[model samples]
Target: MKCALVLCSLSFLYSQICHSANIVAFMPSPFYSHQIAFKPLWLALAKRGHKITLIQPNVIVENNENITHIVLNGTYDILDKYNHVHSLVEGQSVMKVLYAALEAVMEGLEYQLTHPGVQELLKGEKKVDLFFTEFLLTFGFSLGRSLNAPMIGVVSMDTTIEGHMSAGNPTHPVMYPDRDMPYPLPLTLKERMLNTLHWLVDRVMNEIFLNLQDRVASKCLGQQIPLNDIIKNVSLVFINANPLFNVVRPLGPKTVNIGGGVHLMEPQPLPTELQDYLDNARNGVIYFSLGSTISSKHLSNTTKEVILKTFSQLPHDILWKFDEEIVSKPKNMKIMRWTPQQDLLRHKNIKLFITQGGLQSVEEAIFNYVPMIVLPFFGDQHNNAEKMVARGFGLTLDHNKLDVRTFRSAILEVINNPKYRERTKESADLVMDQPMSGLEKAVWWTEYVLRHGQTDHFRNTLSDIPWYQFLLLDVILCFLVITVIVAYVSFKLLQLLKCLAYKLYGKLTRKIKTKIN
Candidate 1:
C-alpha cells in the first residue's frame, strides 16, 4: 500500500512539472503604452509557475523569481522619435503618419535584435517552450521560428484591419470602419466609399512595409521564411479589445479578445498628496492627461494658454499631468509630472477624465465609470474618441479648433449633464460583469495553446480561401453565365415554336379553302 501511494504521488508531481513552460516574450516596441498593455499577460504567466524572459524597452519587472527581465539599451530614445514624428505629421494623412511610425518601429526592432542578450538567445542556448511577441512587429515572428517554439501574437490595442486580415477575421468596411478613420457607424455612401479606400490604402501599405521588415528579419535569422506564412501559422492572438469599446466584428478562432485585461486588477493606493487633494475637493475633480507618449510640454504656447485659461473658469478642481511646472497656474488646479492614473480614476471625488483617448486610458476610464472629454491627436485616439461619443458617455473636441471659450463650455456641459455619468456607470457595470477577468481568460488560452500545440483546429477556413472564392465572385459569374445561356436558348425555342404554329395554321387554311371549293 505504501509503495502504491509513493508511486501515485511521484506521478502527480511529474504531471505538474510537465504543465509548466518556459515562455519568452519579445516586446521591443519603444512605445511605453504598448509595454503597459503587455505587462499583465507576462506577469500572469509568471504567477502561474511558468518561467518568462521578457525583452521590453521601458518596463522592468523586479523581484520575480519566475521572470527574468532583459532590458535593451539605446532603445529609450525612441520616445524622442515619437515626439518628432507627431510634430511633423500633425495634419498629414493617416497613411503618412502610419508609415512614419512604422519606420521608427522597424528601427527599434533592429536595435533590439542587435542587443547582446537577444543575440545570445537567438544563438539557441536557451530552451524555450513558447514564444510571445507583439503582432504589429513582423520581425519578432522570426525569433519564434528560430527557437522552434509555437508563436502567439499579442495585439496591445484594439484589433486593426491589418491584424484581422492576417488572422482571416471577417471585415466589412461598410459596417466596421478602418482603425484610422473616426467616422461613426451607419455610414453614409460617401463615408463608406472613403472607408473602403482607407482599408485598401492601409492594406497595401502594410504589405509593403511588412515585406521590408521580413527581408531584414530573414537576413538576421540566416534563414528565409515568408512573413505571410509566419503570420498565418501563429498559434493564437490575444487582443486587448472588448466589444464594449470595439466595433462588433467577426474574430478568428485563434483570436482571443482580452480587452481591459490590465485594468481588471484592483488599483494601488494613491500618493499622499494626491489623496489629500482629492479628499479636499468639494466640487469634485477633473483629471487631464495626454497619456505617456505625448508630452504636455510639447503643446504650442497658444494651446497651453487656452487650456490653462479654460481650466481657470471651471468650478471643479483640475489635476493636469504636465512635465514642467506652470508658473501662473490657476489656484484651483494642481500639476503633477506623474500620478497613478488608475488610482486617481478610482477616487469617488473624481468627476471626469480629459484625455487623448489612448486605449489604455479609455479602458481605465470605462472600468472606473468616469466620463471623458477627449482631444485626440493621432493613430487610434481619434477612433477611440468617436466610439466613446457613439456610446453616449463622452464627447470629442478638435484640438486645432480648441479655444478658451470652447474648452470651458465643453467642461461645464459635461459636468452639468447627469446622463453622461449615469450612462458611464452603466457601461462600467456591464463591462465588469464578465464571467472571468481578462487576465484569467488570457492565462487559460495561453496554457491551452501550450497544451494543445499548434492551433490548426482554431484556424478559420476563410484564411485558406482566396479572396475571389471567399467573396463568391467566381460563383456569381458562373450563375450569371448559366442564366444568360438559359434565357437565350428559351427565347430561340419560343421563336421556333411560333413559326411552326403559323405554318400549321397556313396549311389548315389552304386545306379548308380546297374543301370549300
Candidate 2:
C-alpha cells in the first residue's frame, strides 16, 4: 500500500510539471529578415516548455525535444523575384510594384501549403492549442480552422493599412499613411486625398486577394472556409512595430505592438577580424548594407562604381556587406558576404548607417543610436526613409538618381550634422523605454491567450461591422434625409402663409372700394 501511494504521488507530480501546450507557427516568407524578426518570440515560447511545430522556408533555429522544424523547399528566391519584378514593372506605378510583390509572396505560400509536413499538420492528428503566422498572408489563417485552434498574427513590418483595418485599429490615412506612401503625418489636403484614395484601392485589392486566398485554401484544406471569417476570429496579433517609428493610432486589444521585439536580446560577439577593425577605427566608421533581399552584386555596374568611388572619398572607414568580391576595392572599405549587423551597430565607433531602409535594419539603427542615410529600393523602405527624414534623424536619396557627388555629400551631411545624432539618441531612448521588453510582452500575451482559451473579450466588435456602417455613413445619410425633409416642409409652410396674407390684402382693398361708392 505504501509503494502504490508513492507511485501515484510521483505520477501526479509528473503531470503537474509537464503541462505543455502545443503551438504551431507557419512563416513561409523567403526573406531572412522576416525570420529574424519572428525568432525571438518562438524561442521564448519554446524555452517555456511548450511544444512548437514551426513551418518555415528556412530553419532559423535548431530543433530540440520540444521544437519541431518543418522546412519547406522550393521557396521563391527573393532577390531573383525582385529583379524579375523590377524588369517587368519598370517605370510602372508603385501600386503595380506592390501587387507584384504580393503575388510573389502568395506563390511562396502556396508552395508551403502543399508540402508534406504542412499537409500532415492539416490532417489534424495532433491537437494544436494555438497557431501563429505572418499577417500579410491572410490565407494562413485557414490553419486555425484546420486545427480548430486560436490564431495569432505576426507582422514582420509595421502593420499594413489592411492589417490595421482587419484588427479594428483606428487608421487615419492623413495621420497614418500606408506603408507604401512615405508622406509625413499631418498631410496637406492633396496628400490626404491621395492617401484616402490609396486606402480605397488597397481595400478593393485586398478583397480580391482574400477571395483568391479563400479559394486556394479551400482546395488545400479539402473544405470550404471563408478567409474573412478566419481573419475575424484571430485571437491576437503581434505587430513588429513600435509607436516610436509609427504614427499615433489606436490599436485593438487583440493587437499587441511588439516593436523592437527582435532587438531585446544582447547581440552576439563579432568575428575577430571585424572586431579588430572596429576597435582600431580612430576616425569613426560607417556601416552600409542594403539588407539580405537586395544584394550589392545585383546593382548596376554604374551604380556600383559610383558607390565605391564615393566611399573611397569619405574620411570614415566603410564596412559594406557586399555579396561578391570587387576587383578594385577601396583601401578604406572592407567587404564581407555577411556581417554581425546588430553586433557591429553596438560598437561606439560606428557613426552612421547607410541602408535600404528595411524595417529591421531601421530598428537596429535606432536601437543603437546610429543615424541613417536611407537609399530606399521598394515597398515600406520608402515610407521608413520618409519617417526617418521627418523625425530629423536621417536623409533620403533616390537610388536611381544617385551620383558620386550626391552620395558623398549625403554621407558628409549626416556625419557632420549634430542634430541627427541627438535625435537618433532621443528616439532610441523612447524605443527602449517600454515597461517590459517586446519579447516579454509578446510571451505574456501569448500565454494569456493560452490560459484563457478564448479572447472574445479582447476582440473588437468593429471587425464585424461593414465598412460603411463603421464609418457612420448610415448615420450621415439619416441626418441628411431628416434635414432635407424638414427644409421642404418649412418652405411649403412659408408659401402657404404668403398666399393667405395676399388674400387678406385683396379682401381689404375690395372693402375700401365699396365704402367709397
Candidate 3:
C-alpha cells in the first residue's frame, strides 16, 4: 500500500512540472503604461510556477524569484528624445504624429536590441518554451524564431492594421477609423477616403520599420532571418481592448480582447490623509490627472492658469496630480505629485474624473463608474474621448482652447446631469460581466499556447489572401469582361437579324408587284 501511494505522488509531481514552462516575455517597450497591463500577467504566470525572464527597461514586478528581469536602464531615455507628445498637444496632422511615433519607437527599440544583456538573450542557448512580445515591436519575432518557440503578440491599444495582419484578422478602414482619428461613426465619403489614405500610409511606414527589424535582428542574432519568417511565427495576439472600451470589430481566433486588466481590478487602500479628504467633502470631489506620460505641470502657462482659476470657483473639492509645487493654492484644492488614482476613484463622494483619456485611464474610469471631462492631447486620446461622449458617459475638450468659462461650463454640464453617471454605471456592468476577468483569461490563453503545440487552425483564410484578391478585384474584372463580350455579340446578332428582315420584306414586295403585272 505504501509503495503504491509513493508511485501516485511521484506521478502527480511529474504532471505539475510538465505544466510549468520557461516563458521569455521580451517586452522591451519603455512605456510605463504598458507595464501596468503586463505586470498582472507576469505575476499570475509566476504564481503558476512558470519561470519568466522579463526583458524590459525597468523592473515592474519585484520580489519574485520565478520571474527574472533583464533591465536595460536607458531605453526610455532614447525614446523620450524622439517622442513628440508635447507637439501633439497643439494638434498636428495624423501622418506627422504617426511618423514621429514610429521614429521614436524605432530608435528606442534599436537601442534596446543593441544592449549587451539583450544580445546575450538573443545568442543564449537557454531553454525557452514560449515567447511573449509587443505586437507593435516586430523585432521580438526574430528572438522567438531563433529559439524555435511560438510567439504571442501583445497589443496595449486598439489593434492597428499591422496588428490585425499579424493576428490574421480583417482590417476595415472605412467602417472603423484609426484610433487616433476623432471622426464619429458613420463617416462621410471624404472621411472614408482620408481614412483609407491614412491606412495605406501606415502600412507603408510599417514596411520600412520591418526592413529595419530584419536587418537589426539579423545583426544581433548573427543569423539571416527574412521578414516573412518573422511574421509567420506569431501563434497568438492578446490585444488590450474590450467590446465596451473600443469599437466592436471582428477579431481573429488567435486575437483575444483582454482590456480593463491594466487598471487595478480591486481598489487599493487609500492613505489616511487622502481618505480623510475624500470622506470629508460634503458636496463632492473631482479627481484630475493627465495620466503618466503627460504631466499636468507641463501644460502651457495660459492653459494652466485657466484651469487653476476655474477650479477655484467650482463648488466641489478638487485633487490634481501636479508634478510641481504651486505658490498660491485654492482652499478646496489638493495637489499631490502622485495621488492614489484607483483608490480615489473608488470613493463614493467622487463625482467626476478629469483626465487625459489614456486607454488604461479610460478603462479605470469605466470600471469605477465615474463620468469624465476628457481633455485629449495625443494619440488615440481624441478618438477615445469621442467614443466616451458617444456613449453619453463623458465630454471632450481641446486643451489648447482652454478658457475659464469653457472649462467651468464643461465640468458643470457633466456634474449637473445624472445621465452621465447612469450611463457610466451601465458601462461598468458591461465591463465587469465576463465569464472570467481579463487577467485570468490572459493567463489561461498564455498557458493554452504552451499546452497546445500546433494552433495553425486559429489563423483565418482572410489573413493569407492578398490585398487585391481580398477586394475581389480580379473576380469583378473577369465578370465585367465576360459581360462586355456577351453584350457585343448580342448587338451584332441583332443587327444581322434586322438586315435579314429588311431583305425579306423588299423581296416580298417585288414578288407581289410582279404577280400584279
Candidate 4:
C-alpha cells in the first residue's frame, strides 16, 4: 500500500508541473517593430512548455522546438510598396493620412489572409487553449472562432479605438488620444476641434474598414465575421505603453501595460568590429536608424544629402543603419545594413541615438539611459517623440524641414545638454522600478488565461452593450419624452386657470354694474 501511494503521489506532482497548453498566435503585422513587444512573451511561454503556433509576416529568426512559425511573406511587400510616409511628413490632413495608412493595412491584410500558408493553418477545427493577436488586426477575431480559443490582444504601442471599445477602456477623445492622433496634451482649441472631427471620422472609417474586413473574411475564411462576436472574444489586452512613461490613464485589470521595455533582453556582445569602433570613439557615437518599416533608401536625395552633410560636420562619430552603401560616405560615419540597437544603446561610449522615434526604440533608449533626437515619420512615432520631448529626454525635428544646419543643431543640442542625459537616467529608474519585468508579467498572464477556461468574468459589461445604450441614449430619450409630457400638462393647466379667472372677473363686474343701475 505504501509503495502504491508513493507512485501515485509522484505521478500527480508531474501532472501538475507539466500541464502544457496549445497556444495559437496570429500576428499579421508586417513591420518587425510591431513584433518586438510580444516576441519575448511567446518565447517565455514556449520555455514554460506551452506550444505556440505563430502566424505573421515577420518570423522569429531564432529557433525554438515548442514554437511553429507560418510566414505571411507578401504582406510586408504590399505595405512597403504603398509608400505613404511622404504624405504624412508633408502635413496632409490627419484623416487623409490615416485613411491612406488604413488602406495600406487593408491591402496587407488581404494578402495575409489569402496566403496559402495562413489558409492552411486556419483549416478545420483544432484544439487551441489561447489565441494571441495584435489588437487592431480585427481579422484575428475569425481566427479565434476557427480555432475555438479565447483571444488576447497584444498592442505594440497604445491600443486602438476598436481595442478600447472592445475592452471598455476609457477612450475620451481629448484625454485618451486615438492611435492616430499625434497632438500633445493640453491640446489647443484647434487640436480639440480636429480630434473631435477625427473621432467621428474614425467611426465612419471603421465601418468602411469592417465592411472591407467582412468581405475579406467571407472570401478567405468562407464565412462572415460579426464585429460583436469579435469584441466578445477579446478576453485580455497587453498594451506596450508602461503607465509611468505614458499619459496616466485608467485601465481595467484585463488590459495590461506591459511596455516598460518589454523587448529589452540581456545585452549580447557586439561584433568585434562594431565593439572596437564604439569603444574607440572618445567623443561618443550617435546611432541613427529610421526603424524597420521606413527605409533610409526612400529618403529624397536632397534629404539624404542634408543628413550626410550634417553627419560629416559633427565631431561625434556616426553609426547609421543604412540598407544601401553610400558612395560619398564621411570618414567619421560607419554604415551598417542592420544594427544591434539594444546592445549598442547599452554601450558606455554611446552618447545619443538619432531615430525615427519608434516606441520600441524609444523604450530601449530610456531603459539604457540614452538621450536621443527624433525625426518622426508616421503612425505613433510622432506621439512617441512628443512624449520624449515632454519628458525632457529628447529633441524632435520635422523631417520635411530637415536641413544640415537644423539637423546638426538638434543632434548637438541633445548630445551636449546634460539635463537630457540626467532626465533619461531618472526616467530609466522609474521604468525599471516596476514590480515585475514585462516579459514575466506577460508570461504569467498568458499562462493564467490558459489555466482558467472561462475568462468572461473578467470582461466589462460595457463592451457587450450597444453603442446607443452605452452612451445612455435610451435613458436620455425616455427623460426627454417625460419632460415634454409634463410640460404640456402644466401648460394646459395654466390655460384652464386663466380662463376660469377671466370668467369670474367678468361675472363680478356685471353684478356690480346691475346693482349701480
RMSD of 2: 4.4
Alpha-carbon deviation at 179 in model 3, angstroms:
4.7
> What overall lDDT, based on C-alpha atoms, would model 2 receive against the true structure?
0.81
Q: In model 1, what lDDT does residue 114 have?
A: 73
TM-score of decoy 1: 0.87
Query: Candidate 3 lDDT, tens digit per residue, 1-517?
Result: 9999999999877654437799988887676677666787888899989999998887888899899888877876766675577557656787887777777766776677788877787678777899988887778778778778888888787677877766677777777666666576688998888988887788787778788778777776654877655675578888887566565677778888887645464667899999999999999999999988887766888898999999999999998899987888889898899876777788899999999988888877877889999998866788888888988987989888889998999999999899999999998897788788878778878877887764788866666676667657799999999999999999999999999999999999999999999
Taken over the whole model, the C-alpha lDDT of each candidate is 0.81, 0.81, 0.80, 0.80
Each candidate structure's TM-score, on Cα atoms with residue i matched to residue i, is 0.87, 0.90, 0.89, 0.89
In model 1, the worst 10-residue window by lDDT is 82-91
Model 4: weakest 10-residue lDDT segment is 82-91
Q: Where is model 4 more than 4 Å wrong at Cα?
A: 1-18, 80-104, 124-126, 174-197, 477-481, 484-492
Model 2: runs farther than 4 Å from truth?
1-18, 63-65, 77-99, 174-185, 261-264
lDDT of 4 by residue, 68-111 (tens): 88888777566657656656655678788777788888787778
Q: Candidate 2 on 1-517: residue-level lDDT in tens?
A: 9999999999877644535689999886677788778777888888899999988877877856778999875675643565544443244576666676667766766677888888888775778998888898778888767888888989887777778877878766677777677676678899999998998788888898888787778767764868887787789888876666677677889898877645445678889999999999889999999998777776777788899899999888999998888889899999889988888999999989999898889888888889999988766788888888989988999877789998998899999898999998997897787688888888888887787776888878777777677657899999999999999999999999999999999999999999999
lDDT, residue 228, model 4? 54
Q: In candidate 2, which residue pairs clash?
A: none
